[model samples]
Target chain A: MTDATASLGSAKTSADALFQRKRLTAFAVPAVIIAYLAYIAIAFDVVGLAQRASGENAVILASDSWSYKTHVTRDNRRGGTTYAIEGERKGAYEDGTRPAWVSGDEDSELVIDLEDGHVVRFLPDNAVAYDVPGFGTIEAQLVDGSLNTNLSDPVPDWINLSDQRMTVTTDAGRLTMTRTRTEVFRYFPGWELFWFTLDSPYHNRSFTEIALGDRIDPDRPNISGAMSDFWNNGMWRHKDVAWAIGETILMAFLGTFGAAMIALPLAFVAAKRFSPFGALRFGMRRIFDFVRGVDALIWTVVLARAFGPGPMTGALAILITDSGTFGKIFSEALENVDEKQIEGVASTGAKPLQRYRFGVIPQIVPILLSQILYFLESNTRSATIIGAITGGGIGLMLTQAIQTQKDWEEVAYYIVLIVVMVMAMDSFSGWLRGKLIGRKD
Target chain B: MTDATLSGPTRREVDRIQDSYMAQVRRRRMYGGLTLAIFVLLMVSGFVVADDRNAGGFWDGWRQMLDFPADVVSEAWEKRANLPGLLVRYFPALMETINIAAVSTLIGAMVGLILSLLSTRGLARWPRLITVFRRFMDILRAVPEIVIALVLIFILGGGPVPAMIAIALHTAGALGKLYSEVAENADLKPVEGLASTGANWTQRMWLGVLPQVAPNFLSYTLLRFEINIRASAILGFVGAGGLGFELRNAMAWGPGRFDEAAAIFVLLFGAIVFFDQISSRYRNKLTEGQ
Candidate 1:
């Protein structure tokens, strides 16, 4: 007893002498993983990563200046807005200081808009050449202050602002508006030409207001022309983006429903416990594994080769891929059914067919239905991948938008639409899955 | 004594019945043959449609896989300058994505474990909760990883973080559902014994319940790891970065770099297979020991 106690004491001392024992690893596995992944991030340049396919076509399509004309309207009911922007081709490069259209960038074309019958056109900051409808062609520099041309010498009656704000002598009358940052008509007038040019820091604050206090400063440059151009044109830029999103939705639905047709039925025979025959079951199971092992993009690329191009390619590719996935899932569900019910049917001297119909199918229907609904939700996103490959959907449009860097606003617009779609799908699927499985959402 | 007279009528009736049955069977056989023909026709049509679309370069892309070692090693080593750029751009994104995945998986696993614990009959009178959780899992699992990524990207913006979260969210749902099934179907005798002793929820779960389902949970988590890794790689295609970004770029701009894409793809697939094999073997050993 003395030796045991002594030994225990010694052991305790030695253990204490060693490193402190940790209940949890101070350096979590996630931390290590994060570090390792950070190494990979170091290798990739997110900004440099190109989102669009820069082919010969994209290269040749490049322009010095892109002019956009637009018409805009609001939909208060849907809480949605609609507009159209038309790009007029340009020739030759222009000064970099020129006021580009709003939401213009490298990957996208010119954007424009019209609000309350007033037309606005947005051009790229680097636009060298421009095409106009009635006026032939005009070249101009980007200015910070507002200037109105072609509206007559005296500003028109519609141009009336608080008379004391500022006076502009025109053919019709003297019209003026106060230049204040808080005014809805005002945007950042001048800022450094960066990647997101024009939408930079210069618009919101008036130089006159900041420098002259209560009075308008003589040094405040007028960017009214640039602002007017942007406001008039930028509103209509979202239409193209909307169209792109619509295409993606179509691709997803067609692919998902078609794939489900094959996957759901095949899942039954694939389940080892419920299979009609061992060989059939094994074969189906193997088929599922093979299809699912590959990436969907790989499938898309493959199908694109087989089918050529267009929405059909995207649809077929998704079908082939989803089949394998749904098959395995459905089969597992089949295997999990209560065997007692199956046995009960069997003891009645019913054939396999009758037993399956009465005992197996009904019990598994909800499971299968739930699976199908989930896959449908999944396929919608996959449709976007297909779009990337075939250039047929919103993904393709997004790629274009990213490449030109001309339609960031459109990019934002499409992003909103896609989010709304996916969220809607998620909610609907959750509800449906709950209903089929007899559970709450 | 009556056998001869009865036999004569029975023979006539049997002949009439047999003749009608034979005719019906012949008609049914023709219909069956037509149906089979239609089924075959549909299969062929699907195949043809698939064929006409894209001849599928994945098989061809495999050929590029062979060029990987030479090109990757050369480019990686010889182009030392580009290496820094590549590392700078890729490593952080990769780490961010992985972190996202790890955190998500950990949280998901906990949720799954908790649900599994609650699924036991003794813990609580909430069969409805279990049922609801299971269906919630179905909804969660049904959404494609890519779709999840896309939605998250929209909500969170383009980054590795969102991709990781997306993967983790789905993993939680799937793992939770699977874990619940494992718990529900576990041997209950010990559970009953523990209950008889008046064990509390946490205690019963720790000592009586967990020991039974630990192997299953481990195996599932490992399996999910393999899946999540592949998912992480692909998330890059949607602006999430890793090997997928490289693959996308290759596809988009530089087909010549396909060798790199092929190499990365091979690595991903190999990693999955290796993890699967190791996890399965380990799991089998564990279950055996248990």
Candidate 2:
């Protein structure tokens, strides 16, 4: 009885110790995480980052992504006025024509109605008048090569006047005057000239008119003309975009399949069952490790230098990197194959090649195919990144557009297309996997 | 005469079966051959098109491929004495890259844990929103990190913060899917018991489910950490600050500053291989018992 009591006491002590250890761990883990996070915050300078963040740039990006601006300018010295969308030459209004919002001849005073009861008028001799809904009319002129504004002693905060430049900002638009030019910007929603530019005959036409009514362009059929105009839209460059998407897909396809083709034989050599020589197998494994260890970014940089930056370089980089991965996975799969099937095939008096083709290939094809298809989907994303580094495919276009910092709408468009492309590839791969492997899952 | 007639029918039946079997085999072979032919055709045409569009043709570049590596190696060898100093100088940048990866992985795994629980069929707090949460994860995964990184860089300026946020978003999506798959297979007994004790949804998940799946979740998170390191470095090349930014600057300096580039290359390669080995080793350990 005494011994039993002592054992029970010991059991109680042990249970207490176990609970203590668990309690300590539960607290320690969170404490360690918090400490590490604190360190990172300080190291990354979160405080400085907050200060450095640009609200104006954010506003520009956010606003530009969904809205477009049309510029109406009067050359103070050249004595002529011009109208353009986003002030781009390709979006310029045709001579003797203007947006409905702007009504007046180029040679005469032009009035721009910037909705919400805001209006801007380009007076003769490089003078401008802006009428704000809440405020009275404000006038500014370039006098003796300097901006002269007629305002009270204390100008409102909305208007910024100086000796060299006069700027007025309102919800409707902005008006700026300087010695050489007076420009009025009117903001509008939506991507302007997305379907067709002003030069296209199909611009501003109703869809029903283009599709069901009569031929809009006398030189060509309605369907073909509308198709060509949309395809060759100058501002959006739909043709170039489609080509870029195709290039990205091609990179993924060639890289994935090419890697699989090359890795199959190499994987065989690396597999212990297939290759008897220890040195060769070891060497092959190390080679795979080396290539993989080099990483794709380094491979891209190296290949881009030699191949001169294009889709081919991106594909080659992906192929080299993924072949290493495929080789490793394939060899692992090979190592797990049942030996009974091979023996059964060998009993039929088949050659070494035939035995592998019938016994080994059939066993591992499903595994290999599934892995290859999965990589194909993932590689599409990697292609976009590698393309950015090597200057090829949609990634190149994306980087170019983002670097411009003014084409946020195009950036948004490219982003949407890229997401769609990736999703489509994901579904396609899933479907193909089901078709090939019979969809066990 | 009856036996002979039966044998004659059996012989005809065998012949018919043989003919059908042969036809099936032939058709299967033809289908396989057609698929192979199409694949070959696609590969060859793709190679040709890519070669045509490249600034340098494949054949032309193939012979010269080793030249660039040779240049870098020779230059690095010539400046071998300075290699140690360069490596030391770039160590801090390497740390920054690793920090970005680690922090993003931590945050991503946490977010992914919540998302997985919310989307899992048997374990969801609200079963009606499972598809909605799943599609949300799908979209998050669909966006490439570079797209978000580039956009954030424009708003946030050049820093590691943008890279961290971009990678974390992707990691959350990827891990959420994997985690949900693991959660779907979890035993429901513990959860039901906890529920009987009047445990809340959060309590049931934390106490009943998390402990069961923590090992697999940790293993996957380690793998993601390995991937995130590479991603962070790449994002750095696109103007996010890290070793990649330094590498780009060095590359831009051309032949004179190749030693810096070489040092960066060595650092990146060593760090990647090191982390890959460590994470894979741990992952193997975690999954070995299961």
Q: Best-fitting candidate, measured by TM-score?
A: 2
lDDT, candidate 2, at A375: 96
What is the Cα-based lDDT of residue A233 in candidate 2? Answer: 86
lDDT, each prediction: 0.56, 0.92
List candidate 1 segments past 4 Å from native: A1-247, A275-283, B1-228, B238-241, B249-265, B275-290
**Most lDDT-accurate candidate:** 2
lDDT of 1 by residue, B121-178 (tens): 5453476686666566766664545555654454344666557667877787779777
Clashing pairs in 2: none
Candidate 2, residue A409: how far the Cα is off, in Å? 0.9
* Residue B207 displacement (Å), model 1: 15
Off by over 4 Å in 2: A105-108, A152-158, B1-6
Range of the 10 consecutive residues with the lowest summed lDDT in candidate 2 chain A: A102-111
Indicate which candidate wins on DockQ. Answer: 2
Per-prediction TM-score of chain B? 0.69, 0.97
Model 2 achieves a DockQ score of: 0.83
